[model samples]
Target: MPSRLRARDRVQGPCLGAPAYGSAVTTPRLVVEEELLRRNIDRVAVGARVAGVALRPHVKTHKCLEIARLQVAAGATGVTVATVGEAEVFVHAGFDDVLVAYPLWLDDDRATRLARLAGRARNAIGVDCTESAARARAMLPDVELMVEIDSGHHRTGCAPGDVGEVAAAGGVRGAFTFPGHSYSPDGGSGAAADEARALAEAGKALVAAGVEAPVLSGGSTPSLAHTDTGVVTELRPGVYVLGDAQQWELGSCSPDDIALTCHATVVSLAGGRVVVDAGSKVLGADRAAYSTGFGRLLDHPDARIVMLSEHHAVIEMAERPPLGTTLRLVPNHVCNAVNLADELWVGDQRWSVAARGRNG
Candidate 1:
């Protein structure tokens, strides 16, 4: 039925012949492949380079110091963090440039720590209100501040038109927006355009009020590809480095690009379902309406993850896999799933989660 193939085709599958009965066999554990990570990193870097924009990748997705170092080494100008503790960890790890992207309500201890940290690194803080600005100014007056504009995320940014007032109150040095609402499947180009317009207007407003808004930053992995460079000077995309089900659904990445996965072994099989060792505790419960299941089965893409528990993940397999077989599970949200593990096994090497429980 088919034509004769070359010698390369005959020497397919395993390069070597099948193993002997007595040969040693070892299973992979918690794998984070270096090749996958490099591919994803290069994809984002190329996209930003083509658009002539600076990429300050968000490190909140993967809180590993080794991964952060890899991101920086891969041409990332700096890193964006979500918490003071995160920033402190990276600073102590020797990352000189950091942006605390969250609008923090600084208390006495936090203010003192932030001030000290700002003095050490090229640091900047986010401000959404006058109270935050006053607190930051009182705590770290010399530290650069960015007015957080609400570019349709409606999370923690001020109104775009209120940029001047917010900047004036906090003595802000720049302006930035998250543009997180652009994650929706239908909200790609339109949302990015709106975010660009909002950031540009906010930057103009801040400059008009005598505040020097030099850093106009706005981006997320979903909007990173669609963003216009004319308005935003810097882009901060976190999940692009290690794609998740959300990124896959948004068409931001392919299945092969997913670098992180839960290496779980099937422990039981009953009721026409196979139960794995990993559950909500390891994989997390971050199902979206568009998502087909809780997580994806790496070996068997057709298998559906029907349910998840504290230490078990139930899969509705078409043809049940062996009970002892190990399956790789890619999470719906890589950030939360990563937070669950104390360490990650990259190939044969193990790396510690330096910032694992640093969610303050």
Candidate 2:
């Protein structure tokens, strides 16, 4: 069996009764448990530190400066972002080291902005093909580059054997992979192994092309526990900070570790179903092939989100808890859910989704 994250203490699950805010807070709001959030961050940070590996968490999951600051304070070397706009946000907030982990097709405006951000901090962008690599080198030579290798996700990244040419063309400082396949049911261990092998081969190819692969970056929330720290000089796992329904289903994180949840109210009980105000708009419609539902109720594991409309989520359950009941829901994918919200609530404290719509 593959190694797993350390077990966590179980809570009473998501808050069932009226939360501290009572009816003052609106329904379908994103709420986080600060203690659980810190616990999650500290656990991963300590693990990476003990293993002598650099922890550069991907900030794309949370997108809030406060949460990113927490990660940095917990000993993260830096952060990884999916877009240059996210990089711009963090770098401006004094995150000195940022990596735009996505392979960006830079136009004049994007190149100029990225170049400016690089001047303010240690920044790198991903590249897979020679054309984009050469373009990055020519357009923003001052910025560092990382060659993306297709470990298993096959979403974006060059083949392991093709890393050398791309690395050479971009003058890349290292190589990285996503291993997104780990999100599949029971795919963690295999995906982790693939990540290690792919990065290793990519590094060798880099050496063959007379390039020094100083940094080998890879990791995702699912494959993180099984990952070989020795294979990756830097680890970049995002969603770990805020456990979601997908993580819960994969057993990557326990229900007690879920820090963020959607505080939804039972709005309708008309059709012999439990319907809440949060739907695809708030929870996102990213149900994976292996996923069982649109989202999961933290307090009620047996109940599943059967249908999700724009402003309503239909919950199929044997017992309907009267209308106006407040429940905590775990979004299928926290990253997408966070992007849809303007702010996150932690008691009376509110955190702006600063990089919420920085998709560009």
Candidate 3:
């Protein structure tokens, strides 16, 4: 432990111990505790098994092959991604099965890329409309296709009834949806129900169209726990493996379930505030409408990141630590925060963010 910093909880270790995090890997570095991370993986894996739902967890959360390997070993049938680029990374890394869950706008170049990826691994692309579905088949003829349904997120995916039209366009394997609206005020269970209903109806619609809707997938972290198995066959909850402040606020995970935290150092202090050298550039500027702040101090749960510049986070703290003290902060959105960093520290060893910039 650092001679200067006193002992506290597990989160306070890097600060209290010598070879302090700041000295090893500058400030504002994303870190993953292996034990906690494995626990999270196990938590979700057990849940999926008990619920009798297939687990094909989204890998955009960690973006690390090491973490994805852990998830696969734990029981994830396959890994899910948001972009074609992400699928390429994992496929090259030997992930046999992958699903680009987002409805991608495939330009000619992206089509050729998906074609090559399909040859290397069992990859599937998403299409929410007939135009995209036709584009997917004509361009990347080798890959499987999943028609996206708008359970409640309304971000992408078509209406459940429209699934038949998209499937009729041909080459569709099944249906998928994201209940992102589950992030709202106490909306997990209800959104889960909504997702099941939408996907079930969508599946029947696809079958009615004679498109063989075998794979029915849907899930997000918050709504994952309440996700029932009937309409949704495969579940993909990314953030459950590395939770964030938003997940904590949604009661999706406890403080202990959070495995990813940023190691930031207190640079200065003012009346009623402590400034840390980690900000939106590293912590991400993803404070959801319902969130309390941009980030949360791990050691000081009550402290809120009141302000965030590109390189500084202004925290409101009751008892501030001295200057140069390292404090671990759990970001509001772990997925975005991880994307901001180059590598992650698992205690002393460094792990590369293999798919950091693989956002297509």
Candidate 4:
């Protein structure tokens, strides 16, 4: 094991003091605490190692090359991305293993891009149907394909038992699924179980179809803790790297585990209400049904972000702070909030969101 990457049983140091929040700092900026960020990264990496499974963390959370490099250095097998553009960015940065986790509809341009990427790295694409699988196999034969099992997400994948034809289509390497329903208030455990069962069934179906399924992948930040590592050979969790309001509220992580925050200033004190400059444009408008509010104050946990405008957040609390007071706002969904920013601050250094806006 590397010296920098600590095991889960390792004793942690005392929590560092808060970042310097003074006149020189700017509001509506995304900031990450370096120590806490590394802590979160190592936690998952070590967890996967302890369970004897591969850790190919989804990079759609931070999208920064620096963070992805950290994961690689900490013993990650590879990195999981959402699009071909993201895969290109990481591959250019010298990441050899990349997985485009989306069931892509490969056009000519995308096929060309993926072929180029596969030439440089050991790459794979997701396929939920035989049509896409055959198209991907024909267009980019060098790239491996992973059948996407629905696994209860019901968003973009096929049913588990139906993965046989997709796997048999061509160039099938294994199977994968996303337990996204784990984001619900009490869906973590159940979703993890469903993910295990689905992946297991998919593996059996692949074998029945005469396809050898070696890589069984399934994981989400909320349900990762409850996942059956015995069934999932590879875990692809993204949000565990950056704690958000939803994770905190769902008891997935403690309040102190949060490593990222939107630094905002109290800009208003009208009618006994407090308003901050961070709003939908910065913090992102992603309030889930189970979310308590738009977001919450990291320091002032009692305060709630009741409303949000394009440029401001209306906060409700008992004691209002002074007009110039600064606060750390934990966004409801860190992934979207990060996409809205061009860069993230870690201490005084800035890291570009290199893969931002690679939506295609």
Candidate 5:
């Protein structure tokens, strides 16, 4: 790399949200609305408080230390992370309580890394099967663990009724599950109900196995509003902080609730199509079967992103603008979009995506 090819050189002018700033800000930049983000955080936090449930929000959405600190200040007990690397990053940044929500099958190296991370904070990883439990124990013998149960998601977790042995094994703490199926239209309530039932069953299993399952965590933004109170002791929703197009379409969140978007430049106005520089790489190619497109054009809500390549988004807009038009596009999946960027812009300020690329 040349000396002139620095990070600063790659950046453009001032941010859009900044008052009295220039209009030539960078394209394909991850832009976060400060006020909207605060509103979103407070919404979930207040709801959890009213429901008498602990808010251990998942931090994989933003992957920014500043955002996690805000969540903690808003009354999050801890944070749920996807991998050991994320836990380490948060723990290093003064977040002592971290839970790796995904099921971990640890080897020697991974185990050692997790153990060290555990030592620096109150760490726990999710375990689905006996094999994962055994491996987790062998790797981080002193760390607490959570038994992941299949709560209608049919994901990595095991059956709630059959997790008795896994929960009773050494280093096990409680049970948790994700309401992943809630993304479907009008499926939030039912998926949340499934989460509650699964947690109850897993709790009973743990009791029968002579283990005290203290923490019962369940969450997903779509199902968060409908998640039953008593069964789940803690909620761990990630996408709520940065509302996406999917959440908007599912009636989980309104347009005003969306706080994050990709700032893109209109590079072409060919026929009825409006092409933008932001595409799958920056906005993410997460067009769910129920979703409208890759991302939603905030400037033109009705415009559909008909096509998305690595570097271009072809939006269908009847009224085409000039070549140098700027627009904000809301991602279909905010988590994936944020993970793709190195930093996020909040008005004129910038926040580093500290946990970015911690996929392992």
Candidate 6:
């Protein structure tokens, strides 16, 4: 078992000093300790640098400009975004390089926005199908494109063998894969190796067809430790900056590496269960088959969140925590949990989620 630090030591770190917690500030707010977040960012940056892979930290996890700037300052080559709105927001915030990692079918309005974004910085779009490529080309003919490969994610991207055809049809710049299957505990490293091989094969296929496959990318938090860059030039791992319950269960990060925590106030206790203010609305109801609960209580590991409604999370504790006591929780999925919050507090500093409600 990994060594666990005491709660006091964990809080005393530069991210959340003892003084920050002692302040008579409001409770029940989402907080991302600056020190811890910087530590996490530096950890991944060092790992990727040692591995000789370009670190394109995905911004979809936090969606905060301050965090994005911090990552860039810490040696990240660029930022990867999940949506056009996110790309635009980052680009407007002075991020020169952005990758829309998701396959986008551009409508007229979206096309205009994407063109504007591509004009601002070095931009790339993921293309999984010919239709998406055609739409993107019609909008921004000179835009760089990455052919998304289905390296076991089965979510998006074309098959590796079909990457050549997609690239040809899209007139893309290179090929990339998400390897999201790396999140599966039973098949994380194996999936990463397999994805690397598939990407290599895809690159060969593109080269044979007279297309220069320059950027071969594949990444996920679970696969970072086992990522093989022989065939890949860049990596896109987001949640590493805010280790969550999912990554913890996958052995991707230690508990101490988690940077973001949702502080909730205990409201009621009865029938051997204690209810907190955070629920699906706060921590998000994203319990994977391998996870223990909606979120984990940092100070009380034995406490299990039994149920989560829209606004209440019923935590079963051996000893009831006093009502009005503040409890810090590490959410199961940091990305979704961040999407639920309007803003995030980073130590004494705070930043609003200027792009929060943008589903587009």
Supply the TM-score for candidate 3: 0.93
List the candidate 1 regions with Cα displacement exceeding 4 Å. Answer: 1-29
lDDT of 3: 0.86
TM-scores, all candidates, are: 0.90, 0.94, 0.93, 0.93, 0.93, 0.91
Candidate 4 residue-wise lDDT, 1-360, digit = tens: 655444522332211124544324557799999998999999999999999999999999999999999999998999999999999999999999999999999999999888777668999899899999988888776668888998887898999898888877767878999999998988899999999999999889888887764689999999999999889999999988989999999989888899999888778887678898999999889988999999998887888999999889999887677776677899999999999999999976999999999988
Candidate 6 on 119-186: residue-level lDDT in tens?
Answer: 67999988888778876787788878888888887888888888767676655767888888887775
Runs of candidate 2 with Cα error greater than 4 angstroms are 1-23
lDDT of each: 0.79, 0.88, 0.86, 0.88, 0.86, 0.81
Clashing residue pairs in candidate 5 (N, C-alpha, C atoms within 3 angstroms)? none
Candidate with more favorable, higher lDDT: 1 or 6: 6
Give the worst 10-residue stretch by lDDT in candidate 5.
12-21
Clashing pairs in 2: none
- 119-234 per-residue lDDT for model 2 (tens digits): 78988898888888999888887768898889989798989999877866745788999999998888999999999999998888888887764688999999999988878889
Q: State the lDDT of candidate 5 residue by residue for 1-360, as single tens digits.
A: 655555545344332332333545658799888999999999899999988999999999999999999999999999999997888899999999999999988877778787677667888889899888887777667878898998998878999997887865676778899989998999999999999999999888888877764688899999998888889999999999999999999999998888998888778776657898988999888989998877787657787888999999998876676666667788899999999999999988999999999977
For all predictions, the C-alpha RMSD in Å is 7.4, 8.2, 4.0, 8.2, 4.0, 6.6
lDDT of 5: 0.86
Clashes of 6: 0
| TM-score, candidate number 4 | 0.93
lDDT of 6 at 38: 88
lDDT of 3 by residue, 248-310 (tens): 999988997888888888888765478889989999999889999989977678989999999
